[model samples]
Target: MHWGYTSIGASTYKGFDVSYTDLIGTFGINFNLFNNDVVRYYSGFRLGLIWRETTPFPAVGGALGFDIKLSKFYSKIQFYLGMRLWTDYREDQKNHFYGDSSGYKRGLITNNALLQENGAIVLSMSW
Candidate 1:
């Protein structure tokens, strides 16, 4: 259990990321929210896969979904649902107890084909 941020360089413009990693027994739960939203209330949550050295940013393992209400100009809400293609990661130090096998590598998998099995839903209403 820990929390912190990383700076790529010494400049006003910087990438920010926060994560929560919990290893309890044989299972774990990881949840993170990225703030790339043009607006403050439009951000989303990435829930799944905890922290892994291979990944530079937190990710949502397994099935994932999110909903966003773009500014107020639009009458419809944007929704998204998808599943992570999984990854194959290996630890530098060989430790058989934890199995160093992964389906994909961190950073290697992004908005590419790995996250392609995704869908979007829109509902419009006038108020």
Candidate 2:
């Protein structure tokens, strides 16, 4: 059992304002819930701050989600998943077309290609 804090967020379409923020207080337990494996299951209560182009103020909301991890000696592959359901966050929000001066704008858009939205499936995989 442990108490911890973690945050994951994405920038607005303009790449200026913060489009979404997920700051969660997590209570997790590590056990062999599935097998004799090291798996940690997490449940979180969270505070969310969101910025939209049309709204006067950043939308405030609450989010609920679970995170699961499977690590260590899985033959060769290491797998981790971080998927959350949020409120007032835009997952399908499109950014404005910025001028490509030095390919900087193009690079920024492609970096971390995860949809910053509420309740949308954002998948992350790494080796």
| lDDT of the structure predicted as candidate 1 | 0.29
Candidate 2, overall lDDT?
A: 0.40
Cα lDDT tens digits, model 2, 2-61, are 344354555445445444333323232323355533333334444334434443323333
Q: For residue 29, give model 1's deviation from the true position in Å.
A: 26
- RMSD per prediction, one decimal? 15.6, 11.0
Candidate 1 lDDT score at position 111? 29
- Model 1, 43-72: lDDT tens digits are 222233333343322234332232243444
